[model samples]
Target: MAALEGRGLRKQFGGVVALNGIDLDIDTDQVVGIVGPNGSGKTTLFNVVTGVHPATAGTVSWQGQDITNIGAHRIARKRLVRTFQQAMSFPGLTVDENVRIAWEQGRRGGSRWASPAMILDFVGLAPLGRAIAGSLPFGSLRRLGLAVALGVSPELLLLDEPGAGLN
Candidate 1:
C-alpha cells in the first residue's frame, strides 16, 4: 500500500480551479517531486493532501486509510507532516525554542534523533540554535523550518519548494 495517495483530487476556489482530477501515489520511503510554473496547483495539492484546505472533490488516503478532510492536526499526528513554500517559523522565538515547540506538539514515535537539539544538529543548525529565528539569513531560516519539521519525526514529509530560500 502507498504511504500517501490522492485519487481524483480536485480543488476549486470560486470559479478558479486549482487542482483538477489529480492522482498521485507515494510509497514508503519514496522521494517524489511535483514541478510546475508559478500559479500552478502545486501548493494547492499539498494543502489538500495535508488537510490545510479541503478538496472540492476526490479522496486522500494514508496507508490505505481515507484521510480526506480529516484536518491538518490529525494528519500531522499520523506522522505525515509538511513544510511551506516560505520558511515558516515562530519569528519571535529562538531557533531552539521553535524546534522545541514542534517537538512538544508533534507526534512521538521514537525517531533516532530523540530531542530538539539533535534535530537542530541533524539539520546543520546546531551552532545557531540560540539565535532569534527572525534574525537568521534566508537559508538558515529554511534550515530552521526543516529542523522544526524534523522535530515532528514525520513518516512522510512533503516539502513545498524545499529549495526556495537556499538559492
Candidate 2:
C-alpha cells in the first residue's frame, strides 16, 4: 500500500475552490515535490492533507488509515510533518533556542532525541546557533525553518516552497 494517499480531495474556502478532484498516491521512501504558480493549490493541498484546513469533500489517508479532517497537531503526532512557504521560527530567540523548542515539541519519549545542535549542524546553521534568529539573512532563515521542521524527524516531511526565499 502507498504510504500516503489522497482521493478526490476537495477544499473550498467559502465561494472559491482551492482544490478540486485531487488524487495522489505516494509510496514509502519516495521523494515527491509539489509545484505550481502562486495561488495554485500547492500549499492548499498540503494544508488539506496535513489537516491545516478541513477538506470540503473527499479524504486523505496515511498508511491506509483515514486522516481526513484531522487537526494539524494530531497529524504531526502521527509522524507526518510539514514546512511552510513563510519562515516559521521564534525570531526573538537564538537559532539554537528556536530549534530546541521544536525538538521538545516533536520528541515522543523519555529517551533523548536528536540534539538541537545536531539538527543545526545538519542544516548548516551550527555556526550561527547563538545568533538571533531574526537577524539571519533570508536564505539562512529558510534553512533554519527546515532545521526546525527536522526537529520532529517526521516519517513524511512536506516542504512548502523550500526554495522560495533562498538566494
Total clashing residue pairs per candidate? 0, 0
Candidate 2 matches the true fold with a TM-score of 0.91
Which residue runs of candidate 2 sit more than 4 Å off their true CA positions? Answer: 109-113
User: Lowest-scoring 10 consecutive residues by lDDT in candidate 1?
Assistant: 105-114
Model 1 Cα lDDT, one tens digit per residue, 1-167: 68899999999999999999999999868999899999999999999999999999999999888999999999988988999878889999999999998887664566646678888988889999899999999999999988888887788999998987775
Query: Which 10-residue window in model 2 sums to the lowest lDDT?
Result: 105-114
What lDDT is reached at residue 70 by model 2? 80
Mind giving the per-residue lDDT tens digits that candidate 2 earns over 1-167?
A: 78999999999998999999999998769999877788999999999999999999998999879999989988878878889988878889999999888788777632135588989998899999999999998889999999888887777889999887777
How many clashes does the backbone of model 2 have?
A: 0
Model 2: lDDT of residue 85: 80
lDDT of 2: 0.87
For lDDT, the strongest prediction is 1
